[model samples]
Target: MNLVFLYGPPAAGKYTIGRELASLTGLALFHNHLVVDSVAAVFPFGTPAFRRLREQFWMDVFEAACAEDRSLIFTFQPEGSVAPDFADRVRQMVTKAGGTILFVYLTLSHEEQVQRVANADRGKFGKLRSVDLLQSLQADFEACERAMPPPDLTIDTGTTEPSESAHRICALMRDHGLAR
Candidate 1:
């Protein structure tokens, strides 16, 4: 179970780095937006119904991934500090995949987050929301910071290039003996 969880503020390149990480390790990428987009397509954004369905779906998928031997890299921006056993299910997943879990978090300045949100003209996910630049990105980052397992790797994405960050993540994964 090569499970690597990538979390960060919007446009902090969680998805991009997660991709590279997955590519390096041959893990599957289950990005945050995939769930949002699938649910939103049927129920549109901001609907309570959509939220329930999406959350439920993700839980099941996570569990199933754990049951099956699959290397997975998923993204999440939780609402607050993670539970003490936050990595339990993920660890199970990685074990199933014949590997271990790695937790990677990306941090950035509020100003950088706001700037990116404003310039995030390319994302379908961003265009759907009405949150002001700072609030939206900051809230998610705050949540992830609070809720995640102690990160195995944390990078200042604001100061680093995406590829560089990804490379460092790979190094962390290797150094931590997470590679199968």
Candidate 2:
């Protein structure tokens, strides 16, 4: 099993690139919002129920995928202070299951992130759509990045096309001998 963990601030094109990566690599896509939106549908965000259910659901999916030796691409937001250990635990789980994890960080200029927040497509996934909220989140993500270990690969979506970014990520996986 192989897990491609792609993370970045809102509007950093994580999902866009993940989709392309999955299409190219045949890895399953498990973007963050799938669980977020589902859990939010029942429990409110940040509530105890939401947190517990979200964590449990994520764990179950990951464990199942690892056990099945499935390769996957997962997109996430940088969770520096809020959930610093989350990614580490996931990595441990994957390695324990004899799987490889590749961390990819996607980013772009803050100005572009802010501008992209209001795109109609974002709302389709219940994504953050406010410029102010995006700015705040990006600051937090920056701090998180400084505290976290560097990713296996980093792409600037503002300069690179999504397809190109995906290709770079796929290349990294191939170089690591995790993909064909």
Candidate 3:
């Protein structure tokens, strides 16, 4: 299984672009919020139970998908709130399963991200909608990025349409031996 890991800050279009990328590549889309929202629904966010369940779900899915050789496109927002070793753990699992992980970092200007965060579609997925919250999160972006694996491909979403970005990602995956 090969993983297309889309790493970016919120409102940088990770999920939006992941959908397009999945459509183009035929890979399953697993946005971070899928587990987050489900767990948050049962336990309060940030509580120990919430964190533990969220991590368990992520690990289970990754393990199952890798063992089955199911390639996936996963949307992620790297925040300091999570365990620092989470990314490394995911990488190790994929590699142990003889899979390649392509890290695609998406970014946009702060002004653009702030504007995009307020879109009504975000609320449907329980996305952050406050400009103040965005600002606080973005303030830690550089620090969060420092801990991530260097991106195999980087795209500035502020200037690129989702389809175009997806096209670029697909091309990268093809070059890296993923046919689609």
**Candidate 3's error at 152, in angstroms?**
0.3
**Tens-digit lDDT string for candidate 1 (23-129):** 77777889887887888888966577887787777767777776675657888655432333445655655566566777788888867766666655536554323
Higher-ranked by lDDT: 1 or 2: 2
Candidate with best lDDT: 3
Q: What is the lDDT of candidate 2?
A: 0.87
Clash totals for all candidate models: 8, 0, 0
Angstrom error at residue 113, model 1: 1.1
Candidate with better TM-score, 1 vs 2? 2
Q: Where is model 3 poorest over a 10-residue stretch in terms of lDDT?
A: 134-143
Error of 1 at 143 (Å): 4.6
Residue-by-residue lDDT tens digits, candidate 3, 1-180? 889999988899999999999888788999999999999999988889998898899889999999899999888888766777888899999999999999999999888988999898999989899988877777587688779988999999999999999999989988999964
Better of 1 and 3 by lDDT: 3
TM-score, each model?
0.78, 0.94, 0.96
The best candidate by TM-score is 3
Give model 2's clash tally.
Answer: 0
lDDT of 1 at 136: 48
